[model samples]
Target chain A: MSSNFRLQITNLLIGMCRGTPGLTAELRELGYREQWITSGFPRDVAGRSHPVMVLASRETRHSLFVEVAPGPRIDSDRLLQYTGTTAVELRRGTNLSREQTETYGIAVFGLTEHRDTLRESIEESGVRAALLLCDAEGIRLDVNPFMQAALANIFRPLLPISWAGVPRWIPFDHESGPADIAAAVVPDVVARLLAGETRIDIAEVCREQVLWKLTTEAGKKRLRASVRGALAEAAGREMRKYFSVRGRFVEAATTSSDDGVPLEHRILRIVSRRQVQLLTRLGGDDRNAEDR
Target chain B: MIARSRHHLHDYLQGRMTGTSAGGTAEQPPPGDTEPIKTYLVEVRGNGVAGRDPDFSVVKTLRALVSEPYLKAGFPARVHPARERGLVTIEGRYRGGTPVSMYADCRDPRHWLIHTLAPGRTADWAIGRMAAVGTRLSRVSMPGQLLEKLAGLGLLEGLILSHDRRQFDEGGGYGAEGFMSMQLWGGQSGRILSMMSRERSLSDSVSLSRVHVRYWPDEDDRAASCLAEIDRDGRMVTRGTSYEGHLHLVKVFRRLYTRQIENLESHFRVRADGDAGKLVGRCLTIRPARPIGNSARFCDIAFSGTPPFRLWGVPAQTSGSFTRVRALDLDVGGALDCEVTPEFLRVFLLSGTSANSVVRFLTNLQHYFHSGVRLLDQDGQDVLEL
Candidate 1:
């Protein structure tokens, strides 16, 4: 997966949970810090390490580990090695039990077929766990109403940021996984969460946010520059078509005419060496006289 | 008696044969024969290869020389450009219908020819005028002394005394009293010095104006002057006059005062008021209105505003008739009434409010309108669609 795509997903997640008090507190209690680093090797006081991947956490504990690889798979050994936490659990095809959620906080696995089951378990337990789910190119899974409600509460309203191009709103009824869900629901959730009212429709909020971003100056400049650049490039190419190099001289064929003059006669005339010398001398004389 | 009669007939016949009136009457002297018999003469001048006929390359120069003088003298001269390497003819009539023909060498300056195509004192006077013009041209070609002489004659409006840095005011003490004094410096790098009232301080016994303008010729050989207006707090208030603005003022003065010393004296005053209405009109008419945001409002007159906000309000009237536009800031509750007259557009801000917010709103309104943004009317309907 591309880093930009990964970053976008990460940002969506952060934006959704950043302003939600309950979600932030819950994550904090569960040891999920903001912008937490997950690395195989560690270094000095700054917690810098090689082969590091960042996840939002609380203190030294992480509540989420987002994986955006092509295939949906769980490498439990690698996860355990990097995290260096024995409490980490790899839940495969089954949903987390109440006892499992209470005991283990980190879950690194695929969420394709287990979305409904997981949603049910989360609703039953009422405990938010650090959930990392891989559903790359997986079939659309149903989102339970309970999980939906939880997400709606956790997400915060978002202000328009510098996003170029017009917003493309995904169809509301279309089945989507965590990434799509985060993108669509987070902004509305954030808005509702800030407004303390859940009456606002998530779809409408999402569409409005898109419109807001499109109208921003930075967005407009980006779009205009893109269009202008394309046009200018086309014009430049057309201009170059008539220019040709011939031996020691570059000849530009006249493709335009003015004042009833024929194109042949309108070809730009080159100044001769003698004329150049004359002009130089004249210019020099004027400069010298001005100096005096 | 027969022989005497025959001699008279012979004289008559001889005069007739020579194409003269009978008995030499055609060549007879003027009625006042005692008066000096003056012959009217006119000189046609040209420049380029002194003795060669003007050709295609030198036609423009010869044509200019031949016709410019007559045109300057307020006569309509018809010029015939040389078809071949020969003479170019300029024919015109003097103010009193005295015909004149100036034949100029197409290839040479020295071979210019002139002829008085009519006979009379009027024709002679016209010829003399042409001669005087030639003399003036020659004098102009001499040193700067001629210009000084012309200035003395009140023909040159702006003649600065280089030594004393003072203008030669033709009307010695004209426009002397005022809150300001103006001195026009004349030279290659012409300067116009405007000394006006400076801000007075507690330490100073008397308030006096100082010469803050310094004009110098720039790279383009154009005169540039900067005007610094300082406030009471000793801070520069104005943007310091632009070179173009100085050039424009100079041009206006030149136009108004050309060859008229009295008008020059009365008009180019440095008083505080200084006939500002007329000056504003001239300035507005000459320069294109400055683009203020996107608003259709255009202003050329410079008016004072509160500190940090100079010329904030623009009084713009539509091109045709008088329509008073009241610009109300929806957010700030500030209003400015724009009165449009046939001569000018003037904006007046309502009292009891700071103009800063209102000015900003107006500027933004202009921008929005210019950018094709639709603005909502009082009824919240999209009325401004342009």
Candidate 2:
């Protein structure tokens, strides 16, 4: 996926998490309170600067710094500092020193390759968690996916509330509905997590609702039809407004309803009202001027 | 009968010569009508990198475009070159009627000025020809095609285009009139915003509009002004001038920008490397004025570098007595008292002023200072001296 797409998805996730009460409650239960999610912070802290996405504590006590699309090899040290932790262990590469890891009290998890390690570390640390979420299919560029079994096993216990399976590329038809989906699924995922469900599958819910499909082809026709309907409705509204104004002008020209007032005066009254409205809308300072 | 006819012919000849006819009706004189010649001035300034080559090339191209074989055959024309001054003169008449002349001056490589004089329909035809030439030259992707096009339309000229990467570079200011579109990156957005605010505070004459900004997703705080429009499309659409139009312009710009941010593009591509240091500043011509001080009115005072040295704010001093000195604060930080006398204006650059800061100060001085004022280097030469 392109960087812009990733950014949009990240923003969507943050907006969903911030807006949902149930999700916030679930996060508070997990001890991740005072959530501060941002694309990148302006200032550097602990000798580290802007991270791709960060969800930090209010007082910088604990945080989750997410790198959505990881490169070939992760910069574990930088990642750790961004999370305000002294040390972190990656499943594929070097692990943090035991003393340092114990002192920092935070474990970093890469969802793709380090899923098994992350699960073990989470159980061992029993403190706070930072996660790197990616696709399991690895169909998108710059996204690394772990094996399905590994993801299921790791997430089964944690029961994390996620915006996964919403489609990496959102169709134009679904533009108006993403926020709505986010609002709905965020609370649902939180409920599932609280219930200790084996899986919290948003994609399954989307599939059932016919909002999306596991196979891209099944959703194409519906998406196109929805987009077409929206455009037609917008165009129809514009035409109606245009014709209505034209009809009013025609009626005003033909009718002699006003009591002996000249046509010029009647026309001026209508025009003057419109002019006043325009001036008011534009914040003209001459508000006290007579309409005539 | 032959003698009578000869006498009549003689009478007719005498009538024609003396403004009278055989039947005693005075002969009507040919129409005595004179049309004024319209003059258009075009000044071209290069983007420092292209040097004078672009300006010279444009003039040469214009001459070639106008002096096509068909045009010469259709109209009485003469084309000549002054190799010494690198100028070309084209004098011609349209369909053997109205006289027209074009003088392209390429004496200064950094600056080229083209002057055209023609009467009525001929003037219109010449301008049209120049526009056609500009359109053809625009395809080459050379620096100065936009300026040339503006010149063709008889718009304002002498606009400096700078994409200079250096922090304290020269040539950064808006012209009295010109068009510029730039994609500012990283911290430059902050600088532009500050400049815009400063310009807003300083003068109401300057107008900036059609601005679009996009924040970096990874660094949301660090936004980029991605799209700026100032007649870059060569549409000749004038910017908003009336107060209502200004309000509307601002509103439209804000609404469009917000919409763009909400619906981001599918793919994000950074500006191309080759486009680095592209021309990004406005070009302005200096109007002439009488000398302020006791010095010779036309003496050349050369400063070491090019004009418009990235100065911020207008020059504070005006022509008057020195007793009532104006205390001025520099944009780069620091205050100085300025003394403006009829003979000369003296500026005191306080201690701890950096060279670059001084250059910036001088740039503004060149622009906003008295028209007669010229900055001289250590050698007593004009700053803009070749």
Candidate 3:
């Protein structure tokens, strides 16, 4: 999702958590583990609680949401320190600054990208797969990829935890499964794809229902070369764009005349192989052989 | 000889083997022709390729039948010389110690498909399907019994046994998915079923004794975990008020000074630009609280309960002249200042062991410093130190 949309939703969630009883109860029912910090230096938000949580909700298909509520109010410097698009820090000194009394905490947020398949989600989530702690909102709060992964495993069995307790007075009868796919195994298929792997079949990977989201908007997204540990044009272009266009760096790169064009597979193929001879020793050797 | 490639069904209709016709002509039979009589057979061929193993092919074909309502072009009904392919993997020792692989080539056709399509056998397979469709089917079935002998109808039956030990869906039977698993219970039951579905493909079937079927989703035999029943041992708790108790003034006041001595000294020096080492000497003091547990009635925090804090004469002291005592920024609101600082008192806290640092912090604070400072992590243990 775009940065703007991500910010709007995150703020909305935080506000709802604080103000709306129904939402808070729902979140708590969905297993939101919010730590209690009643007071701090000047205000509660400023002690920098960073209301962080790793949540997963099987609301639709299955979604994993990781939200780190950065300080509700923070200095510009702190915001810059954690400026990752996925890692957003709240800015301070708004109209609520007076009510906050210069004390506010910012929560950082990171959502695990779409796993789409149930089978894969059961296995891995990149932020330290073992420690991939997910909360109710399908949000994962694993800055450390290793920890995220470890936690993912520890919580895999927990995904199916339901609060509907069976009392002795009740007689039980129920159906086998939902009409639609309710839950799936983890180490989700999309995660495998990002980690340089193919799917069971194109048909399985691309289901009839649901939409596919691109990792980024600007370039050719799926880098087969990158997928297989080869040079990916998109990665280079993205890195180049990140450094040059964003940085104002002199990285011997040029924005193509073809702006507004999404990266295509053909272009990626060309870029992955575009300048091998000039950039590598192997390329130099091949060029020398050609010259000879 | 006619062919029916998936691309175009009519293109391969050579001479139209139209049985519902006016007794075999050029034009294919209309859908209406077989409305009541049901002339066509309904034999479920397990394999699509030649020489396919009858075991899984039969079961998988049954599963597909229940998986959908009608057959599509690629997976069709009634074809000649069945095209089921069975897989084989043989491992044998080679010269290099690596296993060599080879496959057994079979050119024979499956009996289930071709045998049922005999020219005279019309409506034979359909009646069998109609009968089996609604019964509980066990994968471990007697093949001859499975295909009830319809002497007058004249259709061939195969030994279709179910591999699944659990619920199997032969559409609907006594124990089959179609019959038994219509809807699931909610909350705990939902959780269990959802979890089961993820790991296994479950189904049910009717049985002679207990209905059974083959090719059910993997059955996850989950051994339920032992649940813990908790007993709240301590029903005693207080809120919104300070716990009051009597204590020796020295125990309360003396300890308050010593605990704050090191930190207070450092803050004094950092803000004052003074010799900090001479100011904040590690010191110890003692305070008591209402007793509980086998704990020494209190615990230590500042020295990490390790470098064991022990003291006698003075909690802390500097032998230098009292000529200059400078104050910097008010420490968490002058926590260092008290009636004890005539000789620059090094504050220390003597604590009886309480497991709760929060309780210990406040209890020790009441005796020593007479203030509640949330700066310390409930133990009066400073964050910067950790």
Best candidate, lDDT: 2
The estimated TM-scores of all candidates read 0.19, 0.25, 0.18
Instruction: Give per-residue CA lDDT, model 1, range A8-52, as digits (tens).
Output: 343333323332111133332333322322222222113221112
For model 2 the local lDDT of residue A85 reads: 29
Docking class of 2: incorrect
Q: Each prediction's DockQ?
A: 0.01, 0.01, 0.01
| lDDT-best of 2 and 3 | 2
Tens-place lDDT digits, model 2, residues A1-292:
2222333344333423332211223332333321221112322333222223333333323344445323333344443443442334311122222332232222233434545554454445343344444433322111222222322233333444323222111222233332222222222222222222333333332332222321123233444343333322322332121111121121111124323222221132242233223323322221111010
Give the poorly placed runs of model 1, Cα more than 4 Å off: A1-5, A17-33, A36-63, A86-104, A107-292, B1-386
Query: Where does model 3 exceed 4 Å of error?
Result: A1-212, A218-225, A230-292, B1-161, B164-386
Model 1 lDDT tens row, B1-386: 01123234234323322334454456542222212111211112224544654454345653454355654475555655544454445566556354454443322232222322233343344434444322211100101211222223211223222111011112332433211223343332122211111222211111211112233324354333333221111111111224333233223322222223222123221111211111100000110022232123222222112211122222222223332333332222233444333333333333312232222322222221111112222122321121
User: What is the fnat score of candidate 2?
Assistant: 0.00
lDDT of 1: 0.28
Separately for all candidates shown, the number of backbone clashes (residues 3 or more apart, or on different chains) is 20, 17, 120
- Per-residue CA lDDT of model 3 for B1-386, tens digit only, reads 21212112222121122232223345654331221111111122123454655535544544444233322221223222113342221122222232222121111212111111111222222223322322111011111111121111111111111222111122232443322222222224324433443443331121111111111111242221111110011001111111110011112222322233334333322111011101111221111121111111111112111111111010111111111011100101111110012211122221111111222223223222211112232123442223
